[model samples]
Target: MTVLVAISLTTGILSGIWGWVAVSLGLLSWAGFLGCTTYFASPKDGIRGLGLSIVTNMSGVFWAMVIIHLSSLFSVEILGYVVTALVSFFMCVQAKKTWLNYIPGTFIGSCATFAANGDWQLVIPSLIVGALFGYTMKASGLWLHQKLNQPNSKLAAAEAE
Candidate 1:
């Protein structure tokens, strides 16, 4: 819901800047349909984004395969929504954080890039990197969660500021 949208928008914007079109789409749609969802995506949320990203990244490739067959108009929209739902559920479980959710989108995009060149072998390393990215996102989420949740710390001060 709110968490997914927020995460999506944040991640989408970042991904767009980073050149991750698939993930950017997920985030944008979430933002368009759900307002509160983005709150969950901010660094302040927790490990929610990390968990969501794992599914999103993995599923990105799965869904993109769908787009190739069906009309991009229909399949892209459907897959975007599917991504939102999956990521939303994970966010609820993780307390709503969205740092790691960027993986799948980037993964899918990477797949597209490599697949275009017939370099399927690169996916393996990308996967490893994605997992490591997920781990880092989780750890950072925990740390940021603690700091942001604290009542009167300098880190909290920075957050407030």
Candidate 2:
């Protein structure tokens, strides 16, 4: 959809500007895709979804950091994996009950954070920028939808077909 496209483009632009922030362009695209899925699920709840997604994403980063630190201290790879698996299972269950609508964005954002291997401080701003872009895209899409649905527009004629 046009909204997703806009979100992706905006995210890319933000990523370029904050190149040192550690959130890769690929991650931004993933975030945009998540935003699209959330929008599809509930257009009116897009903003709330974005907010929850950001919080959940940062929580994931914190979780990863804790695991990584403990693994380093203990020098046990399996320990880290076990903890991650356990946490993931519980988180998914809770996600369904609490942040059901924002799950996609939250999950993808966390994945991106882990993949980037970036700093926690940087992750906050990066995710915030991504979320803002998604909201902007939604606004643009609404405008486009309005214009396209206008009685005098060619889109109206196409819609009649």
Candidate 3:
């Protein structure tokens, strides 16, 4: 609980600055997207999930956007399902082949932007930012977890003094 709170406060501050940069550059970082995805994807497996989520976001978003653009040519409403199916399929295959089933985070992360923007070009850069932010949070969480778990030997000693 303490670990989670610390991460929230820290990332909140960091994200405020990052959001400013995104606003200045007219680029959407979507840092919270990665944090939520990571939290839900692997609550127990911290470091490993963090690494896999990064890969998933990078590859999944790019391929999903590609499929979205191609499907646009069909000019059909059901094409949305087709695009989602294709993207999900590709991510699943990658997960199986790489032995990292967590790769679904990539698809999960991309789905929103794909539906809203459908701009294939932003896929690469946007997912990259997502992955990086996910990594940052996971690493911080892991660090906090360790610190919190540590025996309070120092505190005990200070209290004795």
Estimated TM-score per prediction? 0.30, 0.61, 0.65
**Cα miss at 147, model 2 (Å)?**
2.8
lDDT by residue for model 1 over 1-161, one digit each (tens)?
24335434445444334334325433222221111222233233334543443344444444444434333345458776765456445433432334344543434433442354423234333443443343443454455555545677766789997
lDDT of 2: 0.56
What's every prediction's RMSD, in angstroms? 12.8, 6.4, 3.9
**Under the 3 Å rule for N, CA and C atoms, how many clashes does model 3 have?**
0
- Candidate 1: 10-residue stretch with minimal lDDT: 29-38
Q: What's the distance in Å from true for residue 151, model 3?
A: 7.1
Instruction: Give the per-residue lDDT of model 2 (tens digit) for 1-161.
Output: 35556545555554454444334543444444443443434324456756666666656666666655655665667887887777666556656655443455545545655665745565555566655555555565666656555577576689899
Give me the candidate number with maximum lDDT. Answer: 3
Model 3: lDDT of residue 142: 58
Q: What's the TM for model 1?
A: 0.30
72-142: candidate 3 lDDT, tens digit per residue:
77878798678768767877777665535665566655674565476545545555565556566656765
Error of 1 at 133 (Å): 2.2
The global C-alpha lDDT for each of the candidates, from Candidate 1 onward, is: 0.40, 0.56, 0.62
Ranking by TM-score: 3, 2, 1
What's the C-alpha lDDT at position 57 in model 3? 59
